[model samples]
Every structure is written in structure tokens, then in C-alpha cells.
Target: MTDLAKTDRPRTPVLDRVTLPSDLKGLSDRELRQLADELRAETISAVSVTGGHLGAGLGVVELTVALHAVFETPRDKIIWDVGHQCYPHKILTGRRDRIRTLRMGGGLAGFTKRAESPYDPFGAGHSSTSISAALGFAVARDLGGDPGDAIAVIGDGAMSAGMAFEAMNNAGHLGKRLFVILNDNEMSIAPPTGALSTYLTRLYTGGPFQELKAAAKGAVSLLPSPMQEGARRAKEMLKGMAVGGTLFEELGFSYIGPVDGHDLDQLLPLLRTVRARADGPVLIHAVTKKGKGYAPAENADDRGHARGRFDVLTGQQAKAKSNAPSYTSVFARALIDEAGRDDRILGITAAMPDGTGLKQFAERFPRRTFDVGIAEQHAVTFAAGLAAGGMKPFCALYSTFLQRGYDQIVHDVAVQGLPVRFAIDRAGLVGQDGPTHAGAYDIAFLSNLPGFVVMAAADEAELVHMVATAAAHDAGPIAFRFPRGEGTGVEMPERGEILPIGRGRMIAEGHSVAILSFGTRLSEAMAARESLSARGISPTIADARFARPLDRDLILKLAAGHDALITLEEGAVGGFGSHVAQLLADEGVFDRGLAFRSMVLPDRFIDHDAPYAMYDDSALNAAHIEAKVLEVLKIGQLDRRA
Candidate 1:
């Protein structure tokens, strides 16, 4: 696992000829092993440049090569769960040319995309979806489609999710000929959690029971042909004693070995065997190591799950130093401070303790923190139960991932009026992850629920106050959202203060126009105010902290004082802006001569790019703000330019 340099990449003469999976069919097992090594090297090199997902792809390199070599892809659909491990698949399936452009604007996607290639039968960025998608392809194939032998390569971490089990149950009932490769690397972004992970661990690491079962199997054949029925019963008993894969068998799936995923010799033969002679549903437990080949990734924490651009020689990531603290860190510190005083406080994350800054909270209060694996739906309900039992549960989740638990949020928390604090991270235009991970619809969705208090932090300092506010308020469900990047370099507060609910602060008072913003777009609104002032138009700027409560007095005051009012937020159309418009329309404010406008994220999914560029594309930037103001003021575009 020596570090690679730009000029000293591994030689892949065989891989150079493999432009498609069809080409892989011609190679021998030895050549395929060599190609796997080359593919692993290529994947590392590509990810080093692009700085996307690394460890999962490295772990699955041999599997990807073997799958391509054995299966007739494009016709034989291979669906990658979460798609993080699809880098090697992308490289082999004729996307190697654009590999370095991973997650870039107008370039290769970091995950498997059906539209990007013929080999990608289904697209996925989120986890635990491949099994269901592959089952659909299987059903379609049975009903007179050409989608051959549907295969789903899902991680063990993904298998912990409820959706995977739902799909497996249905697939088992249908008894379809499907292949589910359980890539049991013992990690998924974070160290795997929950009962399924424990079961898989027992399967791979033989315990006392497994040893007894093995001994029993060896002795079972000693019985005479007249006692063959007894031997068959003994074998079934041995299988029952075997610690792993018994649950899968009970669900009507034929369980196969806990094989070595990295070993090409093991992978090639087993996969070929399954492809040739498998009926009904089959689960192949292939144990692998995340960040398998590369030393830097293997040695590091998280096994190099996700990384920034780094020096291949030293494994030194080129992280840009930020003077300001990240929004995540700010929220983490605030929550830690509050939790120290309030012993009733408890924290929960679905699977993203690190991503949502709950790792810091967990370090401080280990007993109070819970990582519920990748089950968001369970996390929400679990938090609701904690709240019902009189614990102040802060259910922290990414805005995108929160969509998975909406039903639970509605039924358990919102409907029952549980006091669950939702500390939502990654709440806006996350730069490279794109629309698949965007936090666009949370505000609209959450604000619509009765008795739900939705707040967005305007800056890191404001986030501290909101954290305190959410902690202090125990009446009902409260949520506060913050964006992905660093804060605005605002001065630190000694401690958070619990501000009044449903109130906003005015930054400046001006005539003719008032710009009311709901989230971190306050900075853009202020910048637009400066630009407007230079053109002899001084617009008032206000920050609406609460989206749900509507800040009736502040909004009404602004509407009455200003000739034109513009509502801005970093959410979708039906969010804060839409709520304000509804209030204005209901109050008959818009019926008068008040020219109103709501500037929100455009009515489409924006692609991966720099945050500012994505904002510009969505028409929510400073310039766009200025243009909206001018348009509301009845100023022509040409005149404004002049």
C-alpha cells in the first residue's frame, strides 16, 4: 500500500482494454485479479483528485471486478446500495474518462446514476434502497422485460435499515431468483450499530455455538443410510445452532458463506456459482475491509470514508483553514453546554453522529447519546418515547435524511405534542452532494404541521441562542436548522440566551422597501441592501427567526411600514416565503398597494457545484435579491443595468 504519485500510477494494461463489462468476460481469473488490483489503484487515484467517497469503493474493488467479469451487465442489472462503493463500477462501466470529475458541476456523479450510464439500472445516493430497486427489476424481468438476473450489492450497515428487511420479506414471499450480496465490511460511514451488525459479527467470528455446530455437521454423515432421515434432522439442527444467517433462512432466502470480499479467488468462484445455479432469493455474506488496499485509509479513523483532496504520498488532506467555526461545531458546543446543566437532555442520531456534530455531544455525555444505526424512522419514534418518558430528547438528523422519518415525526411527536428537539444539520444548499442531499423541503414540510416550532439560524451566534431556546421550550416539538459551511465570523457569546418565541430582530430601518429573511440568507439580504443603498435606494433588512409562528407582529409591522416587502429564505417555494405570502393574503395586506415578492429556491433540483454558484443558479444570491427588489419597485432591467 505505498503512496501513489501523479507520474507513478499502477500499470493496468489488461484494464486499459476493458472499456465495458463485455470486455471483462474474455479475461481469465488471474488476469481479472490483476485487473482488480489495477481498478483499486485507479479508484484511489481518481478519488484522490476528486475528494469524494474512498473507503467503500476501495473495499468493493475486487467485488466490482468480479461482478463485471461474471455477470452480463447492462442486461444483468447490478444495483449498488447507497452507491458510495460504485466508483470501481463506474471505472469499469466506461466512465473512467470522467472519474476525476466526481461530484463536480456538469461532471460525473459521485454515486451510481442510471442516466449517466446503461450499466447503472437504478440511481441511489441514500442507503438501503438497492434491494427494493433490484426486486422491482426482478419483477419487471419476470413480466417480459430483458433485465437479467437482478443483483443488489448492499452494505451490512444498510441492511440494518427497516426498508431492506421490508424488501427482503416481500422478495422472500415472491421467491424470485435474485442475488443480494451483503457486503459485510463491519462499517458504513461510521462503525455499524444495532442487532443486525451484532448478528453478522457472530456469523463471521465463530463462537462456541458455531464451533459446536461445525463439529455436529462433521459427525452427522457418520450415520447409516437407514438413519439418513436422522442425519437430515441432525443437519437442520446444526444449521439452527449455527449463529449466523439463520434469520435470513427463516425469511425464505438461501444463505451462502461469509466469504472474503477482497480475495478475488474466493469472490470469482462463489459469484460464478451463484450466477449459474441459484434459485429463489440468495444472500451471499461477503466480509470485506473498508479501505482494504490503501494503508493511509486503513490506518485512519472512519477508514477514509469521505475525504478532501489530499497528498497521496503523506495522506495529508488539503483542508482549507477557516477562521470562523463551522455551524456544526457551533451547534455542538451549544448543545454540550446546555446538556451539562440539564441532565434530562438526551441526544439521538440515525447514523450520522460525526456529520451532525453529535460526536462532540457523545464525547461529553456518552450515556445520554444514542446512534440508532441507519434507521431514521426508528430514531424519530425512539426520541418520541424518550420525550414521553420525560427526557428532553434532541433528535439530530440531516435535513435530507429527516424525510425518511416524516411519518414518525407526524404520528409520534407532532400529533401527540411531544417535546422533541430536532437539531437539523446540513439544512441548505450543501455544495457537492447536490439535490440528493439538499435540505430544501424540511421547512415547508415541518412548518405545515400544527404545534411544530420551526426555527432557522441566521448565523452561528444566532444558532447558539436558538439552541438555548429549543432546550428551554418543553411545550411541544421544536426544531432548529443550520447550513453546512462555516459561520459568519461573528463574535462568540459566553452562553446562549433563551430568546422569546416567534420574534425577529431588525438589522436596519429604511423607507419604501423591507427585505425580510428567514434563514442564513440574511447575509445575502444585507449585501443586497448595501447594493440597493449605492443606487439611492435604502431597503430595510430584518431576520425572521421563526418560520412556523410567522412572527405576526413583526411581519405585519414591516408590511404596514414599507411600500414593498420581499420574503427570502433558503428553502423551497412552500416554505417560509409561502407562509408569509399566505399570511399577507389572508390579512388583506397584498390586496392593498403593497407590492409583495417571495424569493426562494427555484422550482427545480439544482446539481452539484460550489455553494455560491448553486445559489446563483437558483436565483437566490445577492444579485438575484437586488433584481427581485428592482422588479418589485417597477424598475426595468435595462434601466437598473444603466
Candidate 2:
């Protein structure tokens, strides 16, 4: 049962008929307009229960309807960039039956997935990938793959990334019959930044409202019915203005639009014209408002970019309150506290100030903070430059997105040995957003980098100390990762302490087996120990705070004394555990009759689910740990075998 009762469901008469995009082909333009309205209402009702990206989907309802109505979809590829705005697309593509299951385990993905349906064409989660994927489809179609037109729907914020421009430049060179729809909603997850956004806004900025409205009326003379169409919306006539796509034109594409994306009159005719007449790469600039129909979403700061399950009538989210502060908030407070002690401490994020908790830092020290739009590569190198100039620059990014700048991290920061503080957030299997957004590889990648110091906080208290440690250390690159969501209700320090580099901390002492853990998995190790204790096996537990340096003495002591040893981390293979095994092998500890095992996230992409459920699937929880310990212990193994 959905959150909304069946009786409360909106009457979607036109939408009821739209079982698939093909069903939409017969609807009249007027009926299409009615369908767009009904689609918006249905989108709101579904997302109200499922709690996904409401605003973007709502904004594109008309566009979604118009595209399906005009194009032969499932054949003509429509690739949605970032894929958050694909909720409405999903509805039209025969997934409405599972629409309520958005972002849940074994349900509809929050972003587009290729495996989901034939209509998807290409999958995308991160921003700025649509054009490149669309171009590939276009080339493939010409080279005897699946036949169809290729269209890429990208947002203004995604356009800020260098890859988008690279794709555009390539598409221009290919000179293929492709469509790039620039959905200028004036928002990404964060408010869009950079000059391109400013340039896009200027397209419709200076026109007088009345004159633009009148110009819209004038265009109806060209239409079949002037009087009826002119009265419908003068906003559509605004497309008649000389809105030049100079930037897109320079890149080898013909440009059309500045059209109101919500107006089917504008969208239908414009898309119809381009589809029929375009010969080379064509870019259509559709001006849309994020959260177009819903008042609450329109008024919200993020324009309902993301939300929790909410009451449709009140927009009241059913969010469970947590007593503990979020790791993000703790990191923010710690960074703020440390910055107060040092004038040179600076904060930076790649268009995720709010997500990374740098919004608070930006509030306290506006000049000292920098949000470099969606350009992660630029943000990384920019931070490196700032660090080289004697500033303590903390480049904060989600571990997944930070991969975009791995080259910059290697060449500019790591090679030069700059004192750049990397604050990698969401450093584990992030739930709901699924595999694309999982922060699983940062440990493996960063740990191996020469002179790079890697640390993971076992709890919120340790995060504070790591923040202070990063601030105080003016040597090479240093990073500390913490998981998403709240801390474990641990007591927080008023200020951070500078922890000694490459040191591990002992949490408990026992015999037979020693459980060495890194990151938030330390808590799970402790739980496993408790379970093991009841079976007459009290396993030793230690937190290996540093992954890079390995805490040589601490690790050697644990391995030499224990009959069995295990390493745990929230990352994948070749990460913390792999490093530990390499160490044990190097020291010939494996020959000392010490049994060793490493528990990690399995080498596969775990799908969207609750964090606990996903962790359970990875077998990194307490029960799995207990079983591993039991299997490793010789006496316990013998008892089980007998």
C-alpha cells in the first residue's frame, strides 16, 4: 500500500490512457496539455510517498510528454543527464506500476539504469555524462547498431563540468544528427555556478515582460489558429525573440529555443520543427523552473532537489529525528573550530557546500570558503594551488565524486607533495543512491599514493581529532573519511586534538583471535566480539586508524601474539585489508603460525537499500564478523566440524 490511499489518488484521465509512450502518439495537442497537467499531479502523488527528486521531474512533465509524443522512443534514444529528473520519464516508459518503489531495495533506481528498460538507452548517475553517451548512441546508430535518433537532456549545472564541453566539442566535430536539450532550470543539486550559467540566464534576461508576451502573440499568425493559440499563453511567443545560441553555435551545432519548457505549445512545435528539419547536431535551449508545478517545491531553497517521504497536502516530511549529530555536521563544526585557531585555514567543495556541511563554514567565513561549481577536477587542483600558496586548504568532496579528479590528485597534489587536506565524505556503501554513488574506492586509491596519509574515524570524536590533525600537519596530502548519517552518540570534544600520524588504538584485549578494524566497521567488530564472548571466545579488538602508514608496531604486536587475525573495512578489495595482508607477508608473520583473514565489501556493486540492509548484503555486519572469527579459530573450527 502506498502512503496515499487509493481514494485520495488524483483523477488522471489522460494519464490513465498513457500505459506507454506509444499510447501518447494519438492524443491531440490540447489533450497533451491536459496530460502534462495530470502527469504533474501524478508525479507529485507518487514522489510524496517514495521521496525522490520531485522538482526536476515536475519541471520536465510537459517536456517529457512532448518528447514522447513527438519522438519514437525505445528506438530514438533519450538519455537523461544525472538521471534525477527521470521520474516522469520512467512513468511514461511503462514503469509507473513500480513508480512508488523509487530508491527502495530491489525497486526503481533513483537515477537512470540501462538494465531497467529499453527506453533508457544509456545509464547515468553522475552529472555531465548524457552528451557523451548520446553521441555514442548516434555513432552506433550510424554504424549499424540499434537504429534511432539520439538526444541528450543535460542541465545547466552539469554543463559546468569540463566533460560536458568535451562532449559538445566532439559532437560538433562528428556533425551527426543529434539533439542536445539544455534544460536551464537554474539549479543542480546546488545552485549552479560558473560563467556558462550566467551566460544561459542572459538568454532571456533583458526582454520586457509585456513586449516578450506580445512577441509570443505575434508568432500565432504563423500557426494554424492565431486567435485561440495567442490567447492560450503569450509566454510561448517569447520564443520568437532573437535568442542566439552563440556558445553552442561556436561549437558546431545549430541552436533553437529559449522556449518555456512547461508550455506544450512551445515545446511541441519547437521539437517538431527541429526533429523534421535538423540535419546536423542541434541544441535546443529550454528555459524551465525547477519544481515548476508544486508550490512547496518551487518555494523550497533546493527546489525540492531531494526529499524524504512527505505529506502531499502539507509538504511535511516524516523524517525521524536523531539525537546524535551527523558526521557532516561534526566535521563542519570541527573545521570551523580549527579555522578559528588558524587564519589560513580555508574550506572548498565542488558544488556541494550543503551536502559536505561547508554551508556552515561559508556562513561563518564567506571569503575563506570556495564552491567551484560541479568541476571536481578544478576544485582539486585549485585547492592544491591554494595549499602551495601557504593556505591550509581542505578540499571536501564525496568519495565517489572525488574520483573525477583522481588525475589531478595524482599529478598536481600528490606528485608535488602539497599539504592539501582531503575531507572525503560518504566514504562507504552509501545507501539509496546505489552503486554509482557508493564511496568505496577512495581508500584503495588514496592509500597507495606516496606521502598520502589516510585515516578513517571510528566515531565522531575521532573525526574531530583527525580534522585538527589535518589542520596542524603542513606535510604532504592528508585525508580522513567518515560515513554518511549521524555519529554513534559518542561524546564530542570542544576542540580537536592532533593525533600522532600512522598510529593505531587498542579497544579491547583477548586471546586466540585479534580483530583489527579500520573505519566505521570498528563498531561492527566490537559487536562481533560481544557475540564471540558468549561462545567462550573473547576476540581482541583494535582500531587501525591509519590505512597508509599501517601502525607497524601495533600491527606486529597483534599478529605475533594472536593465533588468528582478521582485518575489516567498509571499502572493497585492494583497500585496507589488502594493505594489512601485504604487511603481514612482508614481515613473514604468515609463517609464524598466525591465521589471517580480511573482511571487506564483496567485489560487486550492491544495489539501493537501507544502509543496514546493504551492509548485511555485503556481510560486514556483526553476525558475519562473529562467524568469520569462529571459522578462523582452530578449536572453534574443530568443534564446528565435529
Question: Which lDDT value does model 2 have at 560?
Answer: 85
Which tens-of-lDDT digit does each residue in 1-642 have in candidate 1? 323665556567888999988998889988898888888888888887889899999999988998888898888999999988999999898988888899988988887877799988898989999899989989989999875999999999999999999999999999999999999999998888988998898777872111112224464233223333433443565554754567887787877656678878767766776677677888877889999988899998799999898777777898988899999999999999999999999999988989989999999999999999999999999999999999999999999999999999999999999999999999989988888899999999999999999999999999999999999999999999999999999998999999899899999998888999998999998898888887788899999999989899999999999999999998999999889989999999988889999998889988888889999999898888888888888875524454
The alpha-carbon deviation from the true structure for residue 619 of candidate 1, after best TM-score superposition, in angstroms, is 0.7
The collision pairs in model 1 are none
Candidate lDDT (C-alpha), each: 0.87, 0.87
Q: What is the lDDT of residue 24 in candidate 1?
A: 89
Writing each residue's lDDT as its tens digit, candidate 2 over 441-460 gives 99999999999999999999
Clashing pairs in 2: 216-237
lDDT of 2 at 111: 92
* Model 2: worst 10 consecutive residues (lDDT sum): 208-217
Model 1 segments more than 4 A misplaced: 1-3, 6-8, 207-242, 638-642
In terms of lDDT, model 1 sits at 0.87
